[model samples]
Target: MTSSDPHAPHCHNVPGDKSAVQPDKKRLVSRLNRIEGQVRGIARMVDEDRYCVDILTQLGAIRAALDGVAMQLLENHANGCVAKAIGAGNGEDAIAELMDVVRKLKS
Candidate 1:
């Protein structure tokens, strides 16, 4: 499913171009900013000798946040690059590439 929000991830360029997909640039930047802050907080926690469980919990959160980012990018790719390729009469190749990407993501 694609997001309707203009701030959602998507490419502003013409479809089928070699350029990278950029869903909402601002949203991505914001997410990365938060993730960076989380990393710094984790570092501080470690330096302060915080509880092992607390640190582990924060680590898990970080991993989940990163996964969310990946999912957004994947969605953008499918909606932009893959869809454009299919429309450009390269559906078979695009599907194959997308499958490979899914496999890698799963692994």
Candidate 2:
């Protein structure tokens, strides 16, 4: 998905070429792995018949952690892809793509 927020500034302005933006794919993957572990821990808690409130708390934490990952990714996209596109005179498209992403996140 994409966005259409033309006036919304990104973290960094990059070229339109996505290949030019060097993303820390390894770091992202590692974070995701940790989140997976959290999920497994929650499952184990359930099997142990943990308190409902405790399980719910853990679930909330997991959601927050996932949101953190999403924010990081969004920052990277803004600094890399969105920035590049705007610099390359494709700002409209970039903004539209970002808006689409924001919409999905909100939903």
Q: What is the TM-score of each candidate against the true structure?
A: 0.78, 0.74
Q: lDDT scores for all predictions?
A: 0.78, 0.75
In candidate 2, clashing pairs total 16
* Weakest 10 consecutive residues of candidate 2 by summed lDDT: 1-10
Model 2 Cα lDDT, one tens digit per residue, 17-103: 334222566677898999999999999999999999999999999999999988877777776667667767888988998899999
Q: What is the lDDT of residue 7 in candidate 1?
A: 33
* Clash list (residue pairs), candidate 1: 8-24, 9-23, 9-24, 10-23
Runs with alpha carbons beyond 4 Å of true place in candidate 2: 1-22
lDDT of 1 by residue, 1-107 (tens): 33454333343435455676485777888999999999999999999999999999999999999989888888777877676666667778878987898899897
lDDT of 2 at 56: 100
- Report the Cα RMSD per candidate: 3.8, 7.1
Residue 4 Cα positional deviation in candidate 2, in Å, after optimal superposition: 26
